[model samples]
Target: MAATLRNLKIKTSTCKRIVKELHSYEKEVERESAKTADMKAKGADPYDLKQQENVLAESRMMIPDCHKRLEAALTDLKGTLVEIEEELNQKEGPEFEEAQKVITEVEQVLQSTEA
Candidate 1:
């Protein structure tokens, strides 16, 4: 029971952190893209534009990897939940609720990406 609760806490934190990381990566890509666009609009040097494009591309690449990590983390959480569902019913607490919330939030994130 203690182990299950600990797993729930850790998985919850992991999922939440992944969500934040994914959002940060997306914002970084957006910011870099805007910079690249602005540089083009300003007729920035070709070499500088290429470098900014590279940065933007790198940022864009991270997003897919982050999404994969998020999916894996969600799966891990779900598996943990399934392992302890009987225990969870007998020992519902804030940690369990938090885990459920994170699962829903991650699913929403995944759904939005699909759309």
Candidate 2:
């Protein structure tokens, strides 16, 4: 019957479409699996390795900026502290000596950490 043949043609077309979709899905999965295997073989810890590398790259880029900022701050702090200490020493006050000791310790700690 002609109606039967038409129904068969429709079913066949649907089957072909489904097969095409399945093949595409299979290829995508295989591609992902291969990529995963390659990464594993390279001993790449994708979790932090990628993120850490990105962070390191960004931090490296920021190093100059941060160094500039820290250097400026250290310079300003050192100059101010020295001026204050000089004034205090001239006056011979307990407050001046105490302040100098605290600022000096802080500067040392900051320098050590930066190093």
Candidate 3:
């Protein structure tokens, strides 16, 4: 049970990293989109616009998959917390309390992402 909990902690950490990286990617996409629009308004070359369009298209495709993965990771984290709580016989110990705090934080992040 200890090992399983440790693994779940590691997974949760990784998921957090993934969420951070995806947010960075999203910011980059937004910058690129704005640049693309600026170039279009300035009558930039078709080749440049096409390249930017392709990048935006690719980002649009990947962002949803990233969201899905993040959601799955959050679900896994919640499930692991439940298992750990069950293993501990639902005792109100420090570990369970910490887990609940982490779960709440994760849920907040998930909610922000959805918004």
Candidate 4:
């Protein structure tokens, strides 16, 4: 039980870190897109435009893998929760509440990423 809880905590932490990375990558993509648009509007050189486009493409490619990792981490956390649900039900208190909170957070992050 202790090992399961520890593993859950580790997975939760990993998921949180991945989500943060996702947000950071998204922001970078947005910025790159805006820059590309601005450059196009200014009639920038084709070489420069291609460079910006390639960078944007690379960032877009990274997003799917990040999402996959986060999804896997969430699945692992959910599985862990299921495995311990009986124990959690028998013991009711702050630990239970904390576990519930973690579940809710993971669900919310998953939903947002899916959207």
The number of the candidate with the highest lDDT is 1
> Which of the two candidates, 1 or 3, achieves a greater TM-score against the reference?
1
Q: Which should have the higher lDDT, number 3 or number 4?
A: 4
Each prediction's number of clashing residue pairs: 0, 0, 0, 0
lDDT of 4 at 76: 79
What are the models' TM-scores? 0.94, 0.35, 0.80, 0.82
Per-residue alpha-carbon lDDT of candidate 3 for residues 57-81, written as tens digits (9 for 90 to 100): 8876777778788778778877877
Q: State candidate 4's TM-score.
A: 0.82
Which stretches of candidate 1 lie above 4 Å from their native place? Answer: 87-91
What ordering of candidates by lDDT runs from best to worst? 1, 4, 3, 2
> Candidate 1 or 3, higher lDDT?
1
> Pairing residues by index, what is the TM-score of model 3?
0.80
Write the number of the candidate with greater lDDT, choosing between 2 and 4.
4
- What TM-score would candidate 2 get against the native? 0.35
Q: How high is the lDDT of residue 91 in model 1?
A: 40
Off by over 4 Å in 4: 87-99
lDDT of 4 by residue, 42-82 (tens): 99999999999999999888888888887888787677667
- In candidate 2, how many Å is residue 16 off? 1.0
- Among all windows of ten consecutive residues in candidate 1, which has the lowest summed lDDT? 84-93
- Compared with the true structure, all predictions reach lDDT values of 0.90, 0.48, 0.74, 0.78
What would the per-residue lDDT of candidate 2 be over residues 1-115, giving only the tens digit for each residue? 3443333334334333443443454455555556556666788877945654554455445444444544454454445545544644442344435435544554564465365
